[model samples]
Target: MGTKIKISMTAISIIIGFMLAIQFQTVKKPKLRDTRDIWQLREDLLKEQDLQSKLIEEIRSNEDRFDKYETKMKDSKEQALKDTLKELKKDAGQTKVTGSGIVLKIAPFEEAVLLNKRVPEVSPILLNRLVNELNMYGAKQIAIDGERIINTTVIRDINGETKINGRSINSYPFEIKVIAENIKAANKLYNRIQVSPVIDELFVDNLKAIISKPKESIEIPAYDSSIIIQYMEPVK
Candidate 1:
């Protein structure tokens, strides 16, 4: 019985040792399989470093291209916005405009018979009619007494005096600068004003208005006033 017990204990010890050895081999086999020689490890490290460097270079190259693309798009959008703003400024009469046009100068007719009669001052109705006529004949810009005629400009008879842009134009020999679309437009406007019944009526009223031929260039001042947008909004 003692010998059998010792033999059983020895058998148990042998079995435990065998199992431990198998586990040790199982764990160490993977390590041995994964191990590399010294030269091979160095070569693999260099290869990984080269691959990392190449990836970094590729990333930098793509970033540079993206930066250039972004810059180009930004420039293009900025230029487009600038162009739109310039056109808006022009259309709003915020910038001085120069073009080929004509000038209409009006004065009281000098005559002995009309001297005793009250000299007819230019009426607001007459000025309005003249403006409408010029616009009908392709006049692009119109100014009287250095006041630009815009969409919001007001011309009326204020306090028995002709007022343009809320300022009285009570002087004789007043000049009206008209900037037309082109030389031909200027000529057309001039010819229309010369032949219109408004001129005849003015003549009967002892007011003389003379239209000059188309000039090579005529400059119109900008509308120097605050523009208030009361009832406007973007469509989108």
Candidate 2:
């Protein structure tokens, strides 16, 4: 009986030891692994955030440089063209006149939905094309909601939304102000606004077109040097 008791005690000790080892591995090992994995994840997230911040900064700097460069380039090109025009006017015995003109305020209607979308819609391209026509008609200065139209300025859609000059502009009531030397000529030239079917249809509602003759002195800045001249020594 004593030997049998000793054997039972030894078996119980072995079972307890085996259970303790399993408990340690099941509970402690996973907790250690989880801690390691969480630390790695946090580090990775921080790295991503840092990269994003750097990229944003770089983009902003590049944009600033590009803006200056584009403005300068546009000025140079416009100046060269103006000089050529002046020479032509001299030959033709015509003088370029500067006079008070009209300011046209144009904006898209605020209404986004219709009874049904079965009909077509007005797009930004239509507005852009109209602006191009105005420039072609010799508009002295033109601005859309305070964003100046320059040679390098491009009207683009950003992120499936309306935007101009890198800023998000709503499609509601766009204000286009132009200062020209001749209002009659400008109006007569732009009478074909109906050519842009989208603009004519969409802006037909709540779209107020006003031509104001503001005699404000508009000083059109001169253009910069757009071309470079190179001189070579004669048979050096």
Candidate 3:
């Protein structure tokens, strides 16, 4: 029993010594602390804050750029739509046109007037033939006696009088305005009309067709009547 008691006391002493050594080591090595001065610490904090501010500014700048880009895209789309509408209106002959073109003056032939014979009225067939020939020669637009000629124009004989677009051709020496694509086209049209057999055909009917030289600018009136649409519906 005495020997067992002595062995238990020795074990307790060894455990106590191990705990004291661990405590002594902990005391000898103090915890590390920041040793930078207050000014240095403040400068570091300011640097971090400046960096954060720059990042925020960059984000804001990017957002602004994106907004501008979106606005530009929207504006471009609207402009394209406007341009398309304008072109459609022009093509439909709803707008007045000005371009390089020529003028044709129609009057009674000199020979017919001197022969003491009443000048014959202009024939619808002859006029229609003339219009078709002009179109074949690249006439973009045409107007006769202050009336715009569109795709729907009708020239016919109504009660012994030649009528165009339902309006009577009341007198002689009327003007027919013809517009071409450009100055070069206008010149080509002039050259072709000068030698066209249509001129001789007009002379056969006791009428003279005097074609003017190509002009740099000619104005054609727009179609004034309301257009009647057929077999067409708006896209949903």
Backbone Cα, N, C clashes tallied per candidate: 0, 4, 0
For model 2, how does the per-residue alpha-carbon lDDT over 133-215 read when each residue is reduced to its tens digit? 56544455566665655554557777765555565656544566665546565554355333434345445544545445454
User: Whose lDDT is greatest here?
Assistant: 3
Instruction: State the displacement of the C-alpha of residue 84, model 1, in Å, after optimal TM-score superposition.
Output: 1.5
lDDT string, candidate 3, 76-190, tens digits = 9776566667766787789999999999999987778899667777889988988977876778899999888888899999999999989999699899999998999899889
Give TM per candidate: 0.64, 0.38, 0.65
* Lowest-sum lDDT 10-residue window in model 3: 46-55
lDDT of each: 0.81, 0.55, 0.85
* Per-residue lDDT of 121 in model 3: 76
Once fitted onto the true fold, the runs of candidate 2 whose alpha carbons sit more than 4 angstroms away are 1-99, 108-122, 182-201, 204-208, 213-236
Cα-lDDT of candidate 3? 0.85
Runs of candidate 1 exceeding 4 Å displacement = 1-75, 112-114, 233-236
**Candidate 1, residues 1-236: lDDT per residue as tens digits?**
99999999999999999999999998878554667889789866854775676568659966875676567667797765666677667767888999999998988877824567777668888889888767666678999978899888889988898898788898888899999878987887787678766777787678888788899799999999888787998898
In what order do the candidates fall by lDDT, top score first? 3, 1, 2
